[model samples]
Target: MSYNLLTSIDNNRLKQLKNFKTIILNGNNFTSFPSILYQFETLHINENPLCLAPPNDFINDKYISATSNLYVQINDKYEEKLFEIYQQIFIENLTSYDIENLSTRFKLSKTDMNDFREKYSHLKRENKIEILLNIWKQKRGSLANSDALYKFAQLIGDKNLVQKMQKTYLLARKIRI
Candidate 1:
């Protein structure tokens, strides 16, 4: 639905043919900055694709400088949407394309979320206890996700994990009551 925000007109080179004094393409997922539009007196594309790369490509300034916030804002927006999608997937028993999409779309193999990345690594290593604990930390407080987590723990034959998750859920329920 949000794709309608940009139409064929937005992506068309004809849009650049206009003798406009200024051009603003912020928040647009433009893969390449067109050379033809460089004649503009003002151009603002900071939050778009070009800013996602290392700052050195554009300028020598460090990320702590003024240029950094634009990229950070994009990442923050992405993370917020990812969280919402995760919750919805849990509720609907849907599979998350998070891992795949992040790789293909965002071009991120790994992120700076250390705790979460470490937990994911633990799952990859099949470190049973640590993986179980990470699942609880990640999904426990939520209703649908917690149920899915319980089932996963069962499927893995970790009775201890299932009991631990049950204990926390029951304790939280008691407190809520």
Candidate 2:
């Protein structure tokens, strides 16, 4: 619906809607792109707070409307680079306890933080770290750059971890250049 408060849609049930080729989800509170929307012939998802990047399969602009006004989409290569750097940092120098510390410093919304704790807290440390970074990047977009990682490390007051982050990032930059 165009003006309903639908935060999410049931893909299975929605798919069963006979003769409905398009779905208009404007003015909803969807923070993440509903993956199932791609199955529709047309989608109107503007006016929603869709921060997370759409799936790679949803690149066909013909079926979807403008969502750029609501969130900045980072280049896929850049997103991969950021994830690689953070993954290295987390794998080498951080533990679950350290991740917990970092999560507190993320300044994420209470609902987001709670969702992480409820749904993702029991995941393996590495996966948990990845999910945390993904959440941060989606919520903050360009603001969730290397500087934010450095600040999170600094907040933990682990000099060794901070040094490792700096060294790792510098090495990554050197390789890119």
Candidate 3:
């Protein structure tokens, strides 16, 4: 499956494709090479090893030549900006109740909302916000850019936070340009 558009894969699924001569996991967010893929004759994960540290074990492995290199930096700057916006909101003296309210503003699906709450219940308010933002980012995919973040602040009806985030977003854009 060269380009099945998979964002993630699991060990069980890899087992099913074990007999294939070549496997490509290009363009996904793998922090390290999947161990199950080591036996394949040709393995490709061109855009992966997204985490700061690159996997070094298979650097000399003959069958896995393509994945031998390392990523110098994380690629998704948009996701980083979204997290920064949420961090600003959480740090602006928002009360616990207000932070809890903002969590629901993402308009996540019913299942996602419930799953998010249950999974992140033990985290601090700030961590919970970060987790919520991650879920929203995953749900929105490429659409979760600065503009969508601005709209989310508007939806929260916090004019001051909206203005601050807007300014930061614009400054980031200018710097990037």
- Give TM per candidate: 0.35, 0.48, 0.46
Cα RMSD (Å) between model 3 and the true structure?
A: 13.8
Which ten-residue region of model 3 has the weakest summed lDDT?
66-75
- Model 2 error, position 107 (Å): 0.6
Q: Write the per-residue lDDT of candidate 2 for residues 128-175, one digit (tens) a residue.
A: 778887788788887777667777777777777778888877775553
lDDT of 1: 0.44
The regions of model 2 sitting more than 4 angstroms off are: 1-83, 96-100, 173-177
CA deviation > 4 Å runs, candidate 1:
1-21, 31-42, 46-51, 61-64, 94-177
Q: Which candidate model has the greater TM-score, 1 or 2?
A: 2
lDDT of 3 by residue, 1-177 (tens): 444555456878789985699877776655455566766777666644243333455555553444423342333544464556655664463442464567567778879878877888887876776777778778888787656777777777676777777777776555343
Better of 1 and 3 by lDDT: 3
Question: TM-score winner among the candidates?
Answer: 2
Which pairs of residues collide in candidate 3? none
Candidate numbers, best lDDT first, in rank order? 2, 3, 1
Q: After superposition, how far is residue 162 of candidate 1 from its true place, in Å?
A: 16
- Candidate models: Cα lDDT each: 0.44, 0.67, 0.62
